[model samples]
Target chain A: MISALQSVPFESVLAGGLLIGFAALLLFAFNGRIAGVCGITFSLIKHHPTLPSMTWRWLFLGGLVAGTLLYHFLTNTPFPEPPNNSLPLLIGGGLLVGYGTSMGSGCTSGHGVCGIARFSTRSITATACFMAAGIVSLFVFKHLFGWSI
Target chain B: MNQKIIALLAGLLFGAGLAASGMNDSNVVQGFLDVSGDWNPSLMFVMAAALMVTIPGFQYFLRRKPIFAQGFQLPSLKSIDRQLVIGAIIFGAGWGLVGLCPGPAIAALGYLNWEGVVFVLAMLAGAKLRQVQTT
Candidate 1:
């Protein structure tokens, strides 16, 4: 019901994207790690590494939290409003996302942003699949189920 | 210690990007997924811009060894498999259902929203379930 031309937030999107790229670049340049949250989370949970090894991951995540807070304070970006969906939907959605990212080995940042930049065929394929599936899922949920999420 | 500091700063920049791009908002994401409805193509611009910087920077920076690391850590596989496809399918469904990916989810929590808390807890549980084995 809407054209993308009107809805696209150009300035913010561009600025934000640059920042994301910078973040990914710095992470790889310095720590040699992909800024993949799911991957990092898995390592934190499953990798029984020593304290020295574990510290960086925790710091990275902590910085994420801090940066978010700083952005809010500096820019006064309003916090996101919660979706008006059923609890079952929320729970199921969260579970699937967590599992899929783990199984797939990356999410948007790793596969979508960083992977595409690297020109990896696997990342390209995975990103395409993620987008296609999301579109189809949204269509089904809205048209067939008549649910407003 | 220096590695930890840089990592944290990297996380901060990433979070800033997510926030600035309005990705922390579930509605914006849902809008993007809603191709049949109110679609927003801002995500495309975000992707392009990110690639513009990273494609050159990441590829170029690697000519030299990383300052803190011996070498650049990157994924090597170029093959497609069932795990990748199935995982993407499930992830896409969940994203469409709630419009919260891993990065944005964490950013939302930075705002201290209780809704984010619930989703994160469920996500954590889902992740931990991987340790379970079925015989």
Candidate 2:
């Protein structure tokens, strides 16, 4: 088992801390949004009639892409390599996630971050379900199905 | 300051977390998702660290009267229905198969991982399809 403090990249951890802090600062300073993905996506879908909300969603998502690109260009981090998996599996998995997100009413970001942070009872339940599913899937795929990338 | 701005900021922080934690690394994520292989527990540490930062913020918010908004919105429903079970199963299958969830999948852009690209595209497609199905 990996000890909590032993394996972490300290520099990376600090960077992560700073980044989250920055986000909190931005949210407080600017639009006051909670940076929840599911809620944003849900708002976009459910409140399509509201152009302002829709516009914000697009802008927020754009910022996400822009931020990653900015970091990559600045630091010259190597790109992530492709997983050695079949396209069919990829497509299938994506479909499942879409379906799951709809059924669950939010994605990990919505529930895992904003939901849990606010101590939303619903988020707690959703996060628990998300983690449990992830753990169980790993067991089934690796042990029972004997699947490999 | 509105919720949109706050969300934008939160996303940036969350993205940075995903990147720094090596959660964006396909290999590390795959390791976590792979039980048959050299399973990595670093992901758990990342979660703990995130909680360390977030839990305090949460408590702080609780003490105050919504510094950033009129009031904090909390979800009301708490029943486990068929939708919940089915959704969990599907989500687990996807995570097991792809080793990339939505947050880190987008963050993987920093690494320019092809799998990440594929996963994000598929995830978007999934989201679109879900919209259609619901409507």
Candidate 3:
């Protein structure tokens, strides 16, 4: 396994970080929406017709893919291929991520980025829990089970 | 009308940033999660830089009303309850295991990977499961 710490992708990551920040800022300034992917996607999919039309949600999601492609086109750099191929693992992980985000009322974008920006107490607490859980889970998976998926 | 275009632009920028930041890499994300292993601190820098920009940017836009919308859809709940903690724990565990949170998972679709497609479909199904508990 390559050590990410040693060969850190410093430049691209920072560039991406600024872009992410700018995106969140734009959404806030323009739409008054939390740039939380889970929230945005779910609201578009799981809501009733009486609610506001999901026109923007679809466009935003579409733009997400378009933007990446545009980046590839302009920079002549493409995203790497998917590493994981396990069906069960993907399904289980997806279910957990979805259910948990719904239950917790947020995901990485909502809590990690936007929440931290607002300094919201709940976001702070939620962020701490999730990060701790990720660490503990990784420790157990790596050390105890000796599994790497 | 304008909001839709802005929303699309935001999404595009977000997707590009996600890819650029290496958040779309499951292995990289899991490495960042591993506290005892070969930990990657790149995510920390990303968040710090993001917040550095967002915090000040948020304040700057505080006075100005939304151009075409009403106001910011900021979270209002102040208290951290059981749901938040337990849900976060579950989410974190899932994230550590697969490193496919919603943003990256959805964006990964652009890569045309089977895993991304499968993950997104299953995530949508999982999102639907939420209604089962309620209804």
lDDT of each prediction vs. the true structure?
0.81, 0.63, 0.82
Lowest-sum lDDT 10-residue window in model 2 chain A: A1-10
B61-131 in candidate 3: lDDT tens per residue? 76777767877767677888988999898888888878878998888888898888988988888877875
DockQ of 1: 0.71
Two-way DockQ contest, 1 vs 2, winner: 1
Best by lDDT: 3
In candidate 1, which residue pairs get closer than 3 Å at backbone N, Cα or C atoms, i.e. clash?
none
Which residue ranges in model 2 land beyond 4 Å of their true spot? A1-32, A42-49, B1-5, B63-68, B109-114
lDDT of 3 by residue, A1-149 (tens): 45723333689889889999999889888887788888888876665744555888888889888887777778886566574537887788888888888888899888888887777878888889988998888788777898757
Question: Regarding lDDT, does 1 or 2 come out ahead?
Answer: 1
DockQ of each model against the real complex?
A: 0.71, 0.43, 0.71
Candidate 3 lDDT at A33 equals 78
What is candidate 1's TM-score for chain A?
0.89
> How far in Å is the alpha carbon of A146 misplaced in model 1?
1.3
Docking class of 1: medium
Question: Model 1, which residues run further than 4 Å from truth?
Answer: A1-8, A47-49, B133-135
Runs in model 3 deviating more than 4 A are A1-8, A50-52
